[model samples]
Target: MPAGASTGLPLETDRLLLRPWRVSEAAIQRELWTERDPRVPARRRIDADGRPTVADFEEAISAAAVPSSTGLLAVELKADAAVVGYCGLVEGGPETEGEPELAYELLRRFWGLGYATEASWAVIDWARSSGHRRLWATVWAWNVESLRVLAKLGFAEVRSEQHPVHGTNRVTMKRL
Candidate 1:
């Protein structure tokens, strides 16, 4: 298989390995979509028609170029080698120029085990080494778990937007 990226890839923590997505892991992506929180935007969840099916991910994995410094990395357990989730950086839009957005998602079965924080720490180090001066993360205020994780990671709330029904979306920033 191709290496995850040109650099900072296959990052290792004491219990996990941050690597590239594999074509065989399409089902895992689909699972994550299906398991999304109900409060998550509909467009982000698996639809009634099962849009963004495994085939879509297969095509994506097949066509994707080698990841750049800011690409997502698969979070996997080192003991049993099961992929738990993903964590990394993505473009945050024109306003965020040099500050990429940090993102992560883990299977429900793996929650509350410190994996998110651990994985995020690895990504943060990678981001800093990649020369990023800052990073941003957006989380729903209702997701107290994610909020706690962000807090533990040293992100400070910079802004918030209240949704009509889903509550608030908090935007946070962290200096790398």
Candidate 2:
């Protein structure tokens, strides 16, 4: 772990280790978010150019480490100690005030393997225990697999609207 990197709250599943962001994991974080196809069927944002500078990833890890902000947990594969991606709850924006929003992203190679669903369950449980009564997420209307993942996690489609900047429509979901 690098300076300022969190060892993370210990969260585990049968095969995954949900740990805090570590400075040592910066390179992999950059690869996962920037090098992976930006338009991959997930709801999380990815830099389209595949050129996230080291500083960019560092900032992200820092933000995730700030507990008062929103907790972002690095999802590591326990089998090999590989940093696969991230899962956590982000504080909702004005549109979703009073709710925490669930978010997760995985390396493309790890998709469709139940990692997202499993990690989401852990994060949601954490949020619930932390006193959050609702969790929300926004997905691009076309991302069917993500919609399914949210649904499987007990999220229901609450509404849809066009993004003012991206021009893409998004479907919002919530768990109550």
Candidate 3:
């Protein structure tokens, strides 16, 4: 099977190309992780700073690129082929079952250009096409920008939950 067959989607947007992670992208991935906000850490199960070495980034990308797994897509710009960030559906359990959780991040320099909304919309469209009846996402209650993006994608605030580690309330949103 191909590397990202588990993801089962080859999605694209107007100015971005969304695809499975690649081993060759280790350097770029490392750079992005290094530059991530110190507070949130990009919402992965693993603690990024504790494992910020090159090898860790490699493993992360490899895991995300694997087929049939809840994975992250490498978002690259069409004009220059630079990896700006990532956006994709994360598999959720009983609390969010049957609804892939949407997530994304962009390099700080690339912010304010509407890339988040663009990439997110692409993922939503893909989910809709794949027969997913609903989609959901959780954001730090204080993250206004992300909430705006989710809202723009038609996700309404469904509820909020406390994160065990993050020590903050996460606002859950859903779209159907």
Against the true structure, candidate 3 reaches a TM-score of 0.80
**Regions of candidate 3 where Cα sits further than 4 Å from its true position:** 1-9, 41-50, 63-70, 163-167
TM-score of each: 0.92, 0.79, 0.80
lDDT of 2 by residue, 1-176 (tens): 24564434667889888878888788877777554444544443454554466777777777653453247788999999988898987777876765778888888888899999999988877766666777888777667777889888878767777765444545466554
Per-candidate Cα lDDT values, in order, are 0.88, 0.74, 0.73
lDDT by residue for model 1 over 1-176, one digit each (tens)?
22543575789999999988999998998899988989999889988898999999999988875556687788999999999888888889744555689999999999999999999999999888877889999889989999999999999998887889778989899998
Name every residue pair that clashes in candidate 3.
6-67, 6-68
Better of 1 and 2 by TM-score: 1
User: What value does the lDDT take at residue 106 in candidate 3?
Assistant: 81
Summing lDDT over every window of 10 consecutive residues in candidate 3, give the lowest-scoring window.
41-50
Instruction: Give the lDDT of residue 122 in candidate 2.
Output: 80
RMSD of 1: 3.1
